[model samples]
Target: MRWPLTDAARVVAEARVRQGWSRVRAAWFPILQAAVAGSIAFAVGHSLLGHPYPFFAPVSAWIALGFTSDRPLRRVAELSVGVALGVGLGDLVVHVIGTGWWQVAVVLFASAVIARFIDRGAMLTTQAGVQAIVIVGLPALGASGGPLGRWTDALVGGAVALAVAVLTPSDPRRRTRAMARVGVEELAGVLRTLARGLAAGRPSDVEDALVRGRASQPTFDEWLDTATGARDLARVSPAARRHRDELTALVQAAVLSDRAMRNARVLTRRALPLLDPGPTEHDLHAVGATVVDIAAATDDLADSLATGRTPDRARARLVAAAQRLDPFVLAPDDWQVQSLVLLQRSLVVDLLEIAGVSPRDAREVLPPI
Candidate 1:
């Protein structure tokens, strides 16, 4: 067996290659922003302020920017405040006790605990700990040998970040669309896997699909959070005003998709036992085909969400596929079988609702008993 570190490296490397560079592609814009933010912070702190070196400015900006898809202003402000708090605390402690191994431990612990006492945000708590370490590890006097200059630099960096956020904001709609796409694709993937497992009557395949479905919950939650942030940004940021409607739709989509994923997980769990060896090759060809079609429709709708296109045909196809799953005819004998059909139909309705259909209309698409 490989060493644990090597195994971890291998897993990370493999993940890099998975998903067709989608993850890497999504990072380019943020990477560019970070580089630019760093440059801007350094320029303002050093050239403008005549500081020989203003390291913390750029560092603060980078830490604040983070990798969040939305909430730039809030993130930058919270991180800046946390950094200031930590630096102030560290400076006070160092002034009294001087810097040493024991001093470093005390400052870090105090700074972190105080930050937690002040706020519960992850960014705030992290920045506090990190800034305390920076203060204890490095000299208190910032470039130009000025006392407490690090705090000023941090303020400058945070101000620049906030300015950039308001002036040249990242497109929250695009990020929301990306999040929604990931969530919808996850659902489609699970459904497609379920279809394949059912068609082959493989209990193992069904079990694997169930695992996949359960694993997709985090993606759904992330989509909801990202969409919520986007909606909030769109509401507040004047630059994002035009995207308000789209962001709102994405927020609604996040909710609908979450419910659909829940139903999908339930369906996958139920399908596993039905496909056990005792069933002796139950013919699920037609139902499987319909499920696969629903998956295709889901993918189509997901792509449309990303592109802001009308998925009229896909929605119609989804409605038709859902309508075909007549539980009375398909799973009359077993309640377990009937439950799966109902759950699949419910999933389709949720997707339809996410596609802009009214709730009542979305449910009406299902076949009559």
Candidate 2:
């Protein structure tokens, strides 16, 4: 019992460590940008603006920027407005009513109401209320300029954060492409797993494939989200506008891949029952070989998407595979095997569309029934 418990503990610990490392790798760049933005905001407020204690400057900058490249320009503008509104309201309340519990409530209410009136963004209202509360709670001492010194510091911070966000050189499509590759590769892995199961006539392997395909929803969702964000950024950022078409393509690909994965899961589920009764006389080997070919083509798609290259090779491979998906040629008598082939045809068509082939052309690539 002790050994089993210890092993489980070790496994959980390793998994958590891997998750932490992955997060670090994904967020290190955004974290570094936030750090630099905060430092710059503090320097501008304390040195140039002559604010002795402009702590809100860095706080405002960090809050505005957060830690993701997915922020749209409008979001940044909203955050800046929220911070400024909150600071201004907090300053007024502190001077007029004095800092107390009641003052905090009043400032929060005022900030929230004013922010909501200005914009409908939830972050704007939430940040306004939070900043107002902080300002009310903390005493404003050692101020150099005037009663509005902290308010000016907050403005400087927001401006610096906005400047940093705009001036940062970033390819909006990079993260989208990365996520696409991840989603496509996972889809390919499911196909490969299904192939292995079919080749071996193993119900357990098919079951595993179905489970994996189901668990892959989050990856596809993330890919879609990333592509959408890239498209939004392209629309707003002049530097990224040129990549809008490509980002749109990626978004479409993400959608098609998601459909392909769903079909694969269904195919795997259908194949599981046939294997449960043990191997039959059906030509599952041929079916398995076709799945393997599709998996190879999926790998090609992943490579093309990751490198932003034309998926010519992947398209050709999928077309060739599609031509071979004739149910009559592969399984003339077995309806079950033929059904699997039919599902594969739909999945291949989706992959072909993802590779830039139109739906009509993709369907034409398949042989007539």
Candidate 3:
């Protein structure tokens, strides 16, 4: 009871805090880059370029650098082109039609429609409408110094943001590792909970384990997104090109982790009936022991990933645990026992593949039905 109410709550809290910290750390460089790029754009436009209002400049920079790991040149080009199209069309319409509520609506529609024809990006089209509204609503801003300063501001802002992206120090691998760590740790925690449930033959414990496994999906999603971003960054970033192998491995690990999580959910679902008090006490204990071994193997694999070592020992333990489950494998005569064994076998296969086993080879190592 104490373990369920106190220990479980504490573990969940700690995992969440750790995940939140990792996210903030991964985002630090991008946040800093955006701030610096925005300030530079504003200073150049307002103080140096002598424009009375350079609001669009910083806005463009922020839009260009919403996230730092994205393709810098592509984002810069998109933002600059979008801003120019909106401002230019808005200026033309408002200058002729005169400043009125209807004119603003007309310019926005025209800019959005024009941007859509030029590009398929939602960002581009959205910026087009927003910039149109700004230009139409503020006539003096469009007339400010620097001669079509708003249009030029967009170009300058984008260029500065691109420069910052190119020059800023970043490590996509760090983000990749952070994401993988969370994913693997979550899987390990689920295994540990399942181990406890099987040992106690407590339905409540299995229910807790199932809830935990189901709750882990968002963490797995974060892993996929982060690893994919890292892989993409490695493709275009010169400094990060050297880490392509590591990033790719992380991406694959994220995929494997997804399969493992889904399998775990199924395992949890199947395990519910197995926890009902039954006559096979000896076999239940054996299965519980094997599950704990698998949990240890899971933890070791996670540690190996963090340290960049081959998880040879953990891999061996995982395979051995599957074999160990053989004696405890009750026949389908007892559906609950058979279902739990089969699902456990599938989970082992996923864990093995994640540890570098081929699918065919991993399944061959499973206990006979």
Best by lDDT: 2
Mark the 10 consecutive residues where model 3 has the least summed lDDT.
327-336
lDDT leaderboard ranking: 2, 1, 3
Give stretches of model 1 more than 4 Å off.
Answer: 1-24, 43-53, 69-144, 279-281, 331-336
Query: Which ranges of candidate 2 are over 4 A from the true structure?
Result: 1-26, 40-54, 71-74, 99-105, 112-122, 137-149, 277-282
Sequence-dependent TM-score of model 2:
0.84
Candidate 3, position 312, lDDT: 96
- lDDT at 86 for candidate 1? 72
Q: After superposition, how far is residue 303 of candidate 2 from its true place, in Å?
A: 1.8
Put down candidate 2 lDDT per residue, 1-369, tens digits, no spaces. Answer: 022444445534543454345446666897889889999989998899888778878888888888866555677878988998898888888888889988888998889989989999999999899888877887767344688888898898899888987787567877788778778988898899899989998766676677667766777887898898889778878878999999999999999999999999999988887876745666699999999999999999999999999999999999999999999999989999999999999999999999999999999999999
Candidates sorted by TM-score, descending order?
A: 2, 3, 1
Model 1 pairs in collision: none
lDDT, candidate 3, at 244: 88
Estimated TM-score for each candidate: 0.77, 0.84, 0.78
Candidate 1 residue-wise lDDT, 164-245, digit = tens: 6667667778777886787788778878878998888866556555666665666677678878887887787787889889
lDDT per residue, candidate 3, 1-369, as tens digits? 123566457656666776677678767768777888899998998898888777777878888787544444555667777876777776676667877899988888888888889888787888888888877888554466544677777767877877876676556676667667778888888878877887877767676776677667778888888788878877987777898887787788889988987888787777776656667542355556767888889888887766667779879998898775553344434555656677778888888887888899888887665
Query: Judged by TM-score relative to the true structure, which candidate is superior, 1 or 2?
Result: 2
Q: Which residue pairs in candidate 2 collide?
A: none
- RMSD in angstroms, all models? 5.6, 4.4, 4.4
